[model samples]
Target: MNHEFMDALNEIVESKGIDKDILIDTIEQALLTAYKKNFGQAQNVEVEFNRESGDIKVYSTRQVVDESDYYDSFLEIELTEARKIDPAYEIGDIIRNEVTPRDFGRIAAQTAKQVVVQRLREAEREIVYNEFIEKESELVDGEISRATPNVVYVDLGRIEGIMTRNEKIAGEIYKEGQRIKVYVVEVRKTSKGPQIIVSRSHPGLVKRLFELEVPEIEQGIVQIKSIAREAGSRTKMAVKSIDEKIDPIGACVGQKGIRVKHIVDELGDEKIDIIKYSDDPAEFISEALSPSKVVKVEVNEEEKSALVVVPDYQLSLAIGKDGQNARLAAKLTNWKIDIKSESQYEEELANGTLYAKEEKIEEEIVEDFEADEAVDLEEVAEFEAEFAENEEIEE
Candidate 1:
């Protein structure tokens, strides 16, 4: 029985990658539980396991007491009897006496097996969780393993991650064994194990894809300021360059739009608009509403809003199908955009509404500047007069 137990212990340690000392500790606990269950009594017993010979020992502890007070055999022992058993046994000393159970090898082995299995499973879950926690919000490629109508599981090498219907790109299809890139939206530790939530529709996925495709973006030569995505339909991105020499748009677009084309292909032919990011709201709003020429842009700094006026012929193009272009531009710029045709703007202008509002705003700005300048002149004049009076007093 000892030989068989040794072999099983070695096999479990090697196969499960569990530590030997932890296995010993676990088996000791299992034996204690089994001894109590089978013996039909709860006693103050402790189990000791020797790894070298796979030997097991059980010991029971009792407090020494006077002969008349000895009532419980498991908890107390007569002092006179303890003295005979060991001459140095004291009254308050915790004496450990061996009480190994008879024919306990089989029961102990069965109980240890159950515990080892449970411990091994918990350890494996912890390992997997630790490995994936650092990968949250990262992009990784994996193959589809299993799928239902609403959920698809991807084989992520030591673990499987799931992508839900909402995380999937609209109109995109998923097939078993097909490989695709995914964004790790979250890594959560749950009762079952690590639940890695992945996605293909997040705007972050677009930014990460660009980082992977464009070396300039990867090296931080160009930064993607914002992204607006309709997932499998269209996307708008604004980019800027830290180095004046490197053209952010040209680098992202690549030669003949090859760089962007790869991203578009990966997104299932989603239309992409790569616009140059500008600090000026007028220039930025105009650039965001691309593929259509803009006649003028009026910005309200206080409200963070813009009035974009385009030619009447370009209004439909600027707004696009169902106002998608304008909507996406608004999202990307984080500004309230009111796009108008030249004729519409002209009507507003003639009714004195647009012009009057503009004059009021401009007048407020001019008044603020004048008030600040007047305050500055007063302080300067006072400082000079004080300096002149001090020089006369010194003389």
Candidate 2:
């Protein structure tokens, strides 16, 4: 029994990564509790446990007095009686009586065992919590262990994490036993276990994945300027290269579509456009609304707005399906884009249209300036004519 107990304690220490000395201290506490409960509470008791040998000892202390008041482990031995036991004994001294393991019964052992197990589990939880607390927003690779309509269970070795429906890329599929990488959106402790929230639809998921796949991004040679994603459908990213030698778009797209292809595969074949970032809003907006040739871009810097003109034939393509393309492009470029056909834009320009009323704004401004100048000239002329009339009257 003693050998089995020692083996269990060693196993717990190794498996839970708990310090043996702390375990020994906790065991002594448990034994002390059990001794008080089983025997009596009034006795001054101390408990000790040897971590190496798993030996438990209990000591009961009492004050020495007269022999007439002798009691079990609490005898008040007289001065003469104590001198007989030890020649140099003193009055009111505390004498300790050691209790053997045999003194504790089955009930005491069972109670102490429960206490040890509970304390060990608590310690293990603290250790695991501390280990993963700082890794909340990191990326992790996990295998799909189970899949449901609303959530997927991913096995992250020591813990299994959950990827919920909203967190998943739209229309993206998952299969059991398939290994997939995910972003750790959140880490929380629950009554059951550590609840790790994973995501496939987050914008940061793409950013971090690119950071992993693209050496340029990892080395800071290429940086993601902005990303606008319609998950599982299409994603547009604006990337800028720090060095002139590296093409940010080409680095992201790799040789013959290898780099982007890997990302596409992970995203369930979601189309991604890796457009090179430009400082000029016109150029950047034109690139963002790609695959369609842009004839002109008129930017309104004050309002953060732009007018993009494409050929009449490319209008539909530039606007995209259900206006998603233009909407996402606007979000990515931080501009309110008004995409129009070249013919339509030219017609509006010819008609001289503003947000309201088509009028030649320059002609109106020139008329107002000329009118003010004429009014000042008329005032000067009237003053001269009045002074000339006064001189003629005086003559």
Candidate 3:
């Protein structure tokens, strides 16, 4: 070891962001292990490094003992032999002896190199872990570097992020070097490094994109109440205004629909329905089912449910393709929605069974009451007949 070697270590510390002292300490430990392996494993050894010259020195320790009690000759030295080195040597006192191997410098250098490399790798892993843990649930842009059938690797500048197949949009495909925005769903610290889990299908991605594009949302003028997304297909969002002057829907849409247009483009032209949020469940449910005209809205406030009636011809439209529109509407309103056509609602009213739930309970109670009334009537008739017959017999 020499000053030149210490300079090289300083350069490594500057480039790798590892503390110089820690590296030196680690190298010392590695040299200690190599010394024991090459010399005597059972002997007590101490290793030290000179800070100025980077020179390593090794020592072997032995306990002083009386001549009669010394059985392990290497681990115990009789005081008679110890007194030659020092007159203060007494029984049970410890002593150190220089045992540095003549050719140990070359061995220590080779051993230190391997240990430093391993420690550098560990330090890098720790750095990556600390960097990404703070970004959980945040949005980031990354380029697709590689893809397997089950996972896609994205180069996020400093580290690679993983996107599983389930995290990807249903209908979208990716190629090498494709730039895309992803939501940081999770950050895991493993033996290798920070495993950043990115997603293109998380509903949060849509919300974050809106925040980036619309200043009103970030400023609290307009608040996004809810979002329901079927990635690669369509999404419905409900927004409301904290400030009365700000039209939440218009603010999100921007002038001539430019704001929403940018988001749609990011999602590969995926459709988005921006609707005004309402305090009233009926009004909100009605708005949530957009692009389909709702004739009337009747709500059961206690149940947080709504009965939506639309034009007879609009029933299919309200239901949408495979009932996606109504499903998304239900999610957006946070309510159970029962959509009906005008004709169907009228038929349910005439039949006296609109809400299947409450109607069943009402029918049960009515049946019990009618049954009691019939039983009383039968008993009264029997008593009246018996009283008349008894009067005739007495007469």
Over 319-379, each residue of candidate 3 has an lDDT whose tens digit, in order, gives 9999999999998888898899999999988987677768789899989988775477778
lDDT of 1 at 253: 88
Q: Estimated TM-score per prediction? A: 0.82, 0.68, 0.82
User: Model 2: which ten-residue window has the lowest total lDDT?
Assistant: 353-362
lDDT of 2 by residue, 297-357 (tens): 9999998999899999999999999998998899899999999998888787787663433
Clashing residue pairs, backbone N/CA/C < 3 A, model 3? none
Per-model C-alpha lDDT, please? 0.89, 0.82, 0.90
Give, for candidate 1, the lowest lDDT window spanning 10 residues. Answer: 369-378
Question: Predictions ranked by TM-score, top down?
Answer: 3, 1, 2
Query: After best superposition, candidate 2 residue 45: deviation in angstroms?
Result: 5.7
**Regarding lDDT, does 1 or 2 come out ahead?**
1
Q: Show model 2 residue runs off by greater than 4 Å.
A: 1-11, 14-16, 31-46, 57-108, 115-139, 295-312, 334-353, 356-395
Prediction RMSDs, each to the true structure: 9.4, 14.6, 12.3
The residue ranges of model 3 lying beyond 4 angstroms of the native Cα positions read: 64-74, 78-81, 89-93, 295-306, 356-395
* Model 1 Cα lDDT, one tens digit per residue, 253-287: 89999999999999999999999999999999999
